[model samples]
Target: MDEYVQLLADLTEAGALGEEWRGAFERAPRSAFIPDTVWAPDDDAPTGYERVTKADAPDAWWSLVNTDGVVVTQVDDGRADGPGIATSSASMPSLVATMLRHLDVRDGHKVLDVGTGTGWTSALLCGRLGDDRVTTVEVDPAIAAEAALRLAAAGFAPERVVGDGLAGWSCAAPYDRIHSTAAVRRVPSAWIEQTRPGGIIVTPWGTPYANAGLLHLMVGRPGEPSHGRFVANVSFMWMRAQRPHAVVEPVGVSDHRGPSAMDPELALEDVNAAFAIGLRVPGVRYEHVWDDADPSGTYRMQLSDGAGSWASVRHTAWDAEDAVHQSGARRLWDEITSARLWWLEEGKPDLHRFGVTIALDGAQSVWLDDSGNPVA
Candidate 1:
């Protein structure tokens, strides 16, 4: 069987591809949107990616395009001197299907597809809801131009715009559904403002500590807060403007040293704990450092606010309690520990139990179970 057929079968078995989107997926084959040159993950490579071209390795290129994994199409924002960080990509097929499923679009419903990327998603939306009803936007001019060309080649042409996706396309204001391929640290007010009452806005939302979860928000009447819960766990590249600040390692003298009763593993082990901690403790980035030379599973969980505050909790196999060291004005370890304890007190609610409310003024309030019970 062909790669496309196999992909469809796998998605069907995995329940990621819904019947409503089956026809659209078939019509919009992923390979058509993928560029001839793509980047594949390689630990040995400088940027964790090694470039592969269709001319050099046709089979590898085809395999990458057909699989459920993401294909890195552009890196370093298409700059020559910039470090090779992934700036744009064709997201995983399963994830695309899942996002579309959450979008819950229907006939006559208009959609604004953010982060056009390779334009595969825009093509699918056009296939499902007609080209006229779909509008796609990309921040990078080069990516947008390439996507427009590919969309036309694939016989799908939705309204394409070259601009920041955070500012939703307002010319076609008040869409029935707004689907974002990129993740955001904060749900843009423009998205909420452009979505009509009772419409849906599905985007990946998360904190700097976590890349994120799929947010499915239902638009309320004007002046009311748009509310929604995280329906799925997803990690997409952050929207360019909203990407997290570069992680800075903790440096300099330690201000406080003490033994903490909490295990460092608790924060990283559970998704619920991580999500809750991320929501409770904002602007903190986390990393786990391990010593491969040691056989024991010993590591340190480091937290930094990227300002001056930093903390480290040493988890040793010999100790029941981890040793905590903190410096700079704020004690990040303390904040994280407090957040973890709060999560436990709340019965360790599943990540889905967490919800967010976006007010007309764009102020966001995260809650557990109900909107009245804020995460704070």
Candidate 2:
């Protein structure tokens, strides 16, 4: 407990921690919510539940929860028997604090929390607004049940519903604030419909082409569309429905490829250029392939159906090759090149200045801001 307090104090000392959010962090003990059999990254080990075991050492687990970064708890539906990848998790303390600050919850405000992973965020909301004024929804039934128990144990139990959070809990309509811990490509209409006209809804929104960013929107009216601007950069697990199907490797492409002797700086520049292309043309798919045995590789970007583009930069600068295969309405590689050239001509501004505008239908467009206006 003392270590946890120190961690919170250190985070606050850094600009990342929010001052108003310390109370919630101090009150919630993350170890109480984490299951005994949690995934550990080392050796893919699954440590059994033991309240006083080394795995639960205050310095070890609490350090992870108290950081400003994310901590993955489950992956691939929690069926992972070992340390694999984290598909879901209790978001990091700093991010939680940031979101709470963005939420601006008041004493009596009704708040609806989406994606109650461990119910920790809901517990914090309940602490601020009272349990009766908070409601949280989780799609996974088992997770919801576990979160309910943890919240109850913390004495901040709120209404925990087991269902798709995409369909906002209408039973408690007209909430003063609607905040989602999940990343969603589409802003559901139900959220707009259930939030009060003046209420705020904040979520991470982006397509597979780019990392999601924080979107802050306000409910316009009961039947009207909500509008808002991108607030900050963030990344989150996609909503269950939005998760993509298994990616099929392109036919005639060998998984084994050789490493490129190309300059690391040049490779990074090209990768950044590809990202710029993705920004200009959303929904385009790309992959970078390299093998340890070889010094040659290819960067493939699929623009649209049947249009496969390949940019192969070999070990030698003079042997670099850019191939375009287009059988569609738009050539993706050309768009990428154009965007890259535009960036070069414009002095290559930082990517953080990019902004997004989300419409009522959940359609979002990223723009490069110039003098406070979207130029692209």
Candidate 3:
């Protein structure tokens, strides 16, 4: 009657835990892989979390672990003093199960698991196919060591490679399947190179403009470009190298000007619109901002990129005449609004309707209906 046991039962009833993956789920219960100290979302805060550890708060830690939400294990490469950027985490069970189901691996298939976070996925692979058929790679040396020790303690041992996952473990090339636990802005050609023809690759696809989803690609011949359709809408932290490296000089918000005819309210409600916008616009980052000056607590969609471009669309309500201001070389808000409008005109394709084709140059072209025409 332990809470974790009850959680397994609940996940099973809900169909999140497949029969094939159940044994792995039971044997490697996420609780075993997670660290004693973890960070969980703070209910009272908008974008903050409270740390819970077995030493100081065992009850809270257990409660949060079994509650089915992401647990931040390391923040800011383990250097941040407080709840900062979550560099590593024990992903929720449902999400893990979703990815595994999409992976569609079978017995005797050699799987290369990218992003050895907590080693839970590797352990699951071990439980199903045995340790011999699984190979895992971690980008962070410290994380690799910790995960290796955890996997060993859990009575599973897979080929552990301490190297950049983006390059892939070429030593074990021609893997029957590949699964990446990280969000990638660009599909790495090395991954396609390493995967065998007819093999499947499952990874999270991220856009710089603030949207992400699951990309399930079925590999063709070695020289053929890897292509696949997005299967789900989900968010993940960016891959290490894909993160912002260069610093952009600061900008005063007062410099931008103009009232936009485009309705800000229309942009905020459509998740599909946001995804389409990100597809058309590259390297753009956006956030929902609020100022106390507005009594209505209206949120402004703020957009910017490394090109010194910035735009903000504020509205007290969606149908109201919202104010928009833009500055710099690129007009981000105009690009986003135009993209959103185009999506509407095209009948609004969902995630599944969209697919990506990775050229030999490693450039990814996202298209709708088919790969004939790339999205703007």
Q: Write the per-residue lDDT of candidate 3 for residues 269-308, one digit (tens) a residue.
A: 5667777878887888877767678736656777778778
Ranking according to lDDT, highest score first = 1, 3, 2
* Error of model 2, residue 27, in angstroms: 1.7
| Span of 10 residues, lowest total lDDT, candidate 2 | 255-264
Cα deviation of 293 in candidate 2 (Å)?
3.2
137-230 in candidate 1: lDDT tens per residue?
9999988998989999999989999999999999998799999988998899999989999999999999988766899999989668899999
For each of the candidates, give the backbone clash count. Answer: 0, 6, 1
- CA-lDDT, candidates in order: 0.89, 0.66, 0.82
Error of 2 at 80 (Å): 3.7
Better TM-score candidate (1, 3): 1
TM-score for each model: 0.93, 0.78, 0.91
Q: Which stretches of candidate 2 lie over 4 Å from their true place?
A: 40-59, 81-83, 222-224, 245-247, 252-277, 295-319, 322-330, 342-376
Residues 233-336 of candidate 2: C-alpha lDDT, one tens digit per residue: 67788899876333233456423233332332332274334344446655554444446666364433333322343333233342233233333445444555
lDDT (Cα, 0-100) at 49 in candidate 2: 23
As for candidate 1, its clashing pairs are none
